[model samples]
Target: MTSHTVQIKLNGSPLSLETSKVAKQADGAVVVRFGGTMVLSTVVAARGPMEGRDFLPLTVEYREKAYAGGKIPGGFFKREGRPDEKETLTCRLIDRPIRPLFPKGFRNEIQVINLVISADNENDPDVLAMVGTSAALSLSGIPFEGPLGAVRVCMVDGKLVVNPTYAQQSTATLEIVMAATEDAVLMVEAGGKEIGEEQMLEALAFGHEQCKQLVRIQKELMTQAAKPRWAFDAKEGLDSGLLEKVRQIATPRVVEALAIHQKQARAEAIAAAFEATWAHLVTVDHVADDAATRVKTQEYFEKVEKTEVRRLIVDKGIRVDGRSVKEVRPIWSEIGYLPRAHGSALFTRGETQALVATTLGTKNDEQKIESFEGDIYRTFMLHYNFPPFSTGEVKRFGTAGRREIGHGALAHRAISAVLPSKEAFPYTIRVVSEILESNGSSSMATVCGASMSLMDAGVPLAAPVAGIAMGLVKEGDKVGILTDIMGTEDHYGDMDFKVAGTEKGITALQMDIKIGGVSVDIMRQALAQAREARIHVLGKMAEAIKAPKATLSEFAPRFVTIKIRPEKIREIIGPGGKVIRGIQEKTGAKIDVEDDGKVTVFSSSAEKAQQTIDIIQDICREAELDRIYLGKVKSIKEFGAFVEIMQGTEGLLHISQIAETRIRAVSDVLTEGDEVLVKVIEIDGNGKIRLSRKQALRDQPALSDKEKLKIVPASAAGA
Candidate 1:
């Protein structure tokens, strides 16, 4: 087939999508390009749905090759390993919006892969890959209900810019990636600097409008190069009779089980109900005990449970936990829970609890991230861990899963806006949140705990940040927006909208719509509710720790920042780093000297840190005239003696200047290795120093008779 291409102007640049010329064997493939960046997106599905599968098995992968950025892999293997955090996040970004658009009950296993073949460094490939995936799925005829579009929007210089360059993004106060259908928004991921709700709404609207144009272009591409859709039944094996029977037997029990307040109890009650229903079907109803039958029975039972849960919220105004729509759960927190930790907090909101700890380190501890753009160092890092025991489950523990990474990234973004600048707080900060118990909104709990831990550690954050997870249950005209939603609500609800920020505004937000999409009005209402919940959480957090601690913990490392001339960096480092190493060895401190003459010392003992700083300052100090120093005599000559003053500085003390009366030889008054008081009499243009011992003695005050009597004469002391 001949290639078909379509192009459109987006964010002051032309974006083009082409298909039919590459990866023809795949169900559908599209190569998308903007500026000099190009990404190839391909979608392939199994010939038929997997038997006994009740859900869509979809996988999305995004990879960037080192060659794309004109570089090679750095490791010994010289090849790419598993997906990094950015790639994993981009994969999620492409999957979240498209997964909801597939036909219901389409259990086919589908894989969507995006490869960044070329990168220009100016434009980001993630959004392009997203748009390409949509186009590929649209052309693949895989029963997808989308020609959706995605766009990145940022507020630069108080103006909303669509797909701003990386430089502009660095300075942007608000940045968001929004995905939407023609009628509504499907997904949103955003981070801001305490931007208000109104401004966020405006930015969302602006991004949505741009997405419509992208959607239009994808449609235009499909019209030119569309292929015949494959024939697949969405509800091939769905038994209506069995579904009704299961619903009749399970609905009442499901409702009763939902009334349980505790998560484990509710789960056990639901499981018992399901077992009883199955037993009744097998014995009384004489149903077959087959794998397909069992799978269908469980599927219908879950469907009934989902329906009842939604009805209880939307129709009856009763949530599973029996809370009102806008009510939050009970919140309690403790600071400094771990005495040995630099900073720690135990934050509990109802059933969800997090034990967060903050560790402070010097520049050596900063994380170095290698990406296509360049290597960058991060001084602040947040990690989230969700062990199986948090939910009372027994499972193998290993590396963090995609869910963990995504949740951690969201929480990291939320709290990062409030962290102090590196210059103000010159210590590397690491916040780790261990989920001790979870019922729902554990990630948001992490956000709250991270804030408290940072304050407890004396991080001097700009403001306290808090996060809340809101759920939406909508049926036609009736809609319910649940605040601080639990696990069941999140599972059965139409939207999971998380908002995090301070009392002033939002710092981060993430929304995923499981239904068709949500309107602007719904989004606005959800944001307002989330803001209220966030503020409530913040208030509870303030009860534990209102602001950063004035002093760090005794166990925490002390930091001292010293600035010197750029040229003095070499002096601090000394020859082959011997001087700096010696200072560190003597003081037991860590010193980091930057090219711009920024020196940071880290030590557990404040005295040691101060000693290290003094050493560095002396090494970088210049000799000042008339200043007196206890100089060490290096050598004695007939003409003069070389006296060492300050670190690494030598001054010439002439024989005549060594005594009040002229001396014939310098050794008479100043012998080698003698400690004598000396004054900096002159400093020449070339940094040579001249010292005077006579002037230093003459400047001293007259001694009292008693003090004079205490001084022993040299001849008598020798005898």
Candidate 2:
């Protein structure tokens, strides 16, 4: 049996990592404890690399097992299966900080398994998991660049706090997870209410200070109980000798073709050049042997090349796309391009086209999200769907790949900068971007098309934001930044730095460098260039549709709101919410109320909303009235009846009023159901009823058929 103990101080709590006391037989195991949460991390290396694995094949999975905190599975699958979005996103977080820490040419089939055995819900287990991974790799003889540490810093009550509890994390205005080398900031992901750039920088500094102790522990683990790291020869990047030879041969002609910058023209020219040399010592002729051929085949093409490609273009005023460096691709677009959709746009830039559609929904249609802080409602969602036909191919149908999610998430962040606040539109919106064509920068095309659809649907966005993917080719000390990278460049270039923003400033940025990180000077240059391209994209977008339309379509629901005292909420809802049910039935509306006295009433028509509002008002109203009684006919011995009058209320009248003229049989003059106006004569002290028709009639005039004698008799009987 082997024993290991690693200790550190985390956010003022004494934390420790111990193995053997827990899961003893794992290939490499470490128990991570921060606050009261415990995450057991284990690293298991496969006997050999999976042969056909296209990628590094390192899997980092963090599971939130139900029994971690004594809860049973709640869904139909019974137990957790595939990773949820949260789990996937967390794995990315862990992988990013550790992936770069590995040494060059060091590839071992590795899988990191993280299990949460206890959750105190105080210190987040995610960051602790990252630290444990570093320790596990440090002691397991895995060639990892890690021994890196991470921390989550939040702004609470105007003060920066380290790794706050779940309760405190919500109230926090800012949440930033910072991972770093001992020297510089390596990775950062954050969500905040428009925090300033400078403040975010400061938060990173605060996090780094907190992460120092964990780094120290990683060094200790590496020094005390570490396996010998594996060794492999580091290939000195792309074949430099072959690259130089090809540069000399192809540089001037390639530069000339690229300077023209027509999508098809540049592509044809490059193909023509490569075709002429197809039979030389180029890629066509290769040696045998499965292993060596794969390596030599890629290497052979470089040696046949000659002259400088980028140097001739950048320095000698030539270009690969046959155009000036600052120029954009030819662009065209249209909206309402599809009539069946609520809102739609077909955007084209060069050969790329994205047919984007937008669907606006009500609050109830919002996406439900479950996170460590429990569940939440998301009012805005953007999804990117790519089918085989988009690229003219066929593949297996499955869930969205990492590329789809990453692109969709990028677009979502870009458009989110301009979306109306929840207090404004109050309707949930979901936008789907379909890539119908491909040339380059499809994600940026989605951004442009999504903006048009949003405007068409009458959403009052702050502005129409756009995105552009910029590429870079770095040779020696020189780097050439290309605007609106094409499909080929994105696959072969050294950098892909996508930027999204309004005309004034940046909204979101995602940069991945192929040859380590970029210098600040290059980043500034790239940012400036991306901004210019974005302005062009935005201008083109405006040609389709401008600002958000003033009103939603007729098919959209009408919103009615009512604010009442918070204490009276229960009164309106009633026991088991019986009153609410009655309101819903009477007016045909869907009503949802928050605890803070805010009520939302949704209906298909304005009339229904008005009717519901009226009924609800009546139920919540108080009123008072005066007097009560009933009156009878004066000579009703043989006559019918009459009644009294009150505000909007009525009673009957009797036929006894003709009494004074004659007295016997009483049937001579009056009948029942006749109208004789009456009033409340008096109120009994005990609140009993009282009535009098004769007194009321005496105060008014009494007209009879014979006394007035307005009719002249014709033949006596017929008349």
**TM-scores across all candidates?**
0.91, 0.74
lDDT of each: 0.90, 0.67
Per-residue lDDT tens digits of candidate 2, residues 1-719?
66767786655787887765665555567888887788888887765545533346687988876676666766787786777666666677677667666654444578898887887756678887877777787777666666667788888999998878887787877777766656555555555554554565567678777777677877876676677875544463445554555455455555555555556666677666554433233544332435443344333333232233445445754444555666778888888886766677888887788888887677779888754445679989998877767666687667787667767877887788678877767778889999887766888888888888888878888888777888877778767788987776666566777777777665656655555445556766877788789889889888888788787666666778887677657767878989888888988887777799877787878999888777666555422122323222333443443332322123333333333444455344333323333434544564333334454444445433233221112233133
Best by TM-score: 1
Candidate 2 off by > 4 Å = 1-27, 52-54, 97-108, 153-175, 183-185, 190-216, 235-286, 289-320, 323-335, 338-352, 438-440, 519-525, 565-588, 623-719
Which candidate comes out best when scored by lDDT? 1
**Stretch of 10 with least lDDT, candidate 1:** 703-712
lDDT of 1 by residue, 171-216 (tens): 9999999899999999999999999999999999999999999999
